[model samples]
Target: MKKPLLMIVGAIAVLAAAAFLYPNAPSGNAAPPGKDAKHGEKGHDEGHGAEGVVEMTDAKVAAAGIEIVTAAPATLHDSIILNGILQPNQEALVQVTPRFPGVVREIKKRIGDSVEKGELLAKIESNQSLSVYEMRAPFSGTVIDRQISLGEYASEQKPAFVVADISTVWVDLSVYRRDLPRVRLGDAILIDVGDGGDPIKAELSYVSPVGSADTQSALVRAVVANDGMRLRTGLFVSARLILSAKQVPVAVKGSALQTVENRNVVFVRSGEKFEARDVEIGSRDSENIEIVFGVMDGDKYAARNSFVVKAELGKGEASHDH
Candidate 1:
């Protein structure tokens, strides 16, 4: 009876121990503290937390579209840009000055009136010498300025009417000193009169050898045929001198280039990050500039405003060093 009681007591104690330990045991095997199980849980939680933080902050970073280009041997026709005023061709502009002093009796043409060659513009009743002199239009053109009116005094040296031929117009382009080498006598030019139509094409007729000391620009004259009588003198126009050759090296938009440390640089997209690269620059048009070095063809580059990426990169570098 004593032996059986002892065996039963031991069996009960063993059962209680097994029940208590089962709850505390790991699902697979009993792992040591701070070992694989504990460490794996901690790491997984940290990983998830880090990923959440990244996702939360990613919305603030602005993204820009980028383009990949390749460098090829291209002809870069360099040019000088200048501002110029439109003037009538010398052969077409006529200033009518009276030969003798007289009193103007009648005025035939007014401002903005179109006249023909040999057309009588005004009839003057002379009182100084009692001789009547009739003023006629020298060329078929529009009257731009009328200095004399009816019954006004007309002097021999005073201009009476200013006539300008609208059949052919001149575009006086202001070429900067830097672009003087690119301008030639026969280069093609495009002139925009801001009339909401296509630009007019013309050929460069002459380039001034001397530059103006005040504006520091040379005058380049282009002659355009105005058979339709569309262009007018003194109309503010934007001129574009087209070069015969394409830009060499690689060309990118001007907005894409930025200054860093007083040097020109462009952000190149690489994988998930952008790389800052210094570049050599060349001639530039209004919208695009020539890239002399640093970028290769087919390499994706950030376009539009890329300052955000540059700031982010700067922060990243700082953080890495820290």
Candidate 2:
């Protein structure tokens, strides 16, 4: 009887120690070791934020300076990029040189001044006749350069003024021999002015049969209409010649392209919110990119400043300590 009693007291002491040591153990909802990966994946999916969907207010869109453009069918060209410089149309350019050796007496036009054809530009005292004579413009144009000043020595060898009609200009492109075979006299040339302006369209008018001594490239000239004087003489420009033309049924500006969640995407403006939509691209040119799958023609997407949407989406999906 005494032994049984001692055994019961020892059992009671063990139960008391167990209850004190393990008062708050894991419940039924507690996860197992292998279950952690499952929970982590769930959090990841939530944090990824529905792939490309980004929502914001109109005020936020305007404040972010997001620009939107309509995707549409566009005429895309396969082009060969060329480096070149803008020059005055040689047909419209004139060098006004003195006919007789003389001393400059008076000057009227300066560089960048405009004069009409047969307009008086300067007066010179003839060395032979000892009398003053006037120099007139040969063509209506802007004075691009003036090498002579008032009272300076003037002669038949020196040009008094160089004028060029900039209503049109020439884009001289350096074409490699390999490109010569593809380039034609009537091919279209797009000249990039580098001022974020529209490219000036020109047609290849001349291609030198001979190559250059320094670069081994032939000179190819394209005449472009420059009504606004956008193309300036000696201005460095990048150009491309269209080899083939094709219709891109659906296309968007390259600036609209963005990478979201490791997928090619475009921020499509849906009503008041811009949603990031996945895209499958086919072909791309210097300005426009062809859309193969994701987006459709006439769908509006963010063009300039689309990165703002990307930034906002990034902030929304930013990780937090749980």
In lDDT terms, which candidate is top?
2
Best by TM-score: 2
- lDDT by residue (1-322, candidate 1, tens digit) is 9999999999999988987978665555756655575644334344222210112122343433334333344455444344567678877788999877788988899989999899999988777667777999988888989899788788878789999876787888888787788678889777877788897878888888799999888888888887667777787788778876564667776776877668788777655545677889887766666887987766666666666656655555444333
lDDT of 2 by residue, 92-158 (tens): 9899998888889999999999999999999999999989999999989899988788787898998
Shift of residue 129 alpha carbon in model 2, Å: 4.1
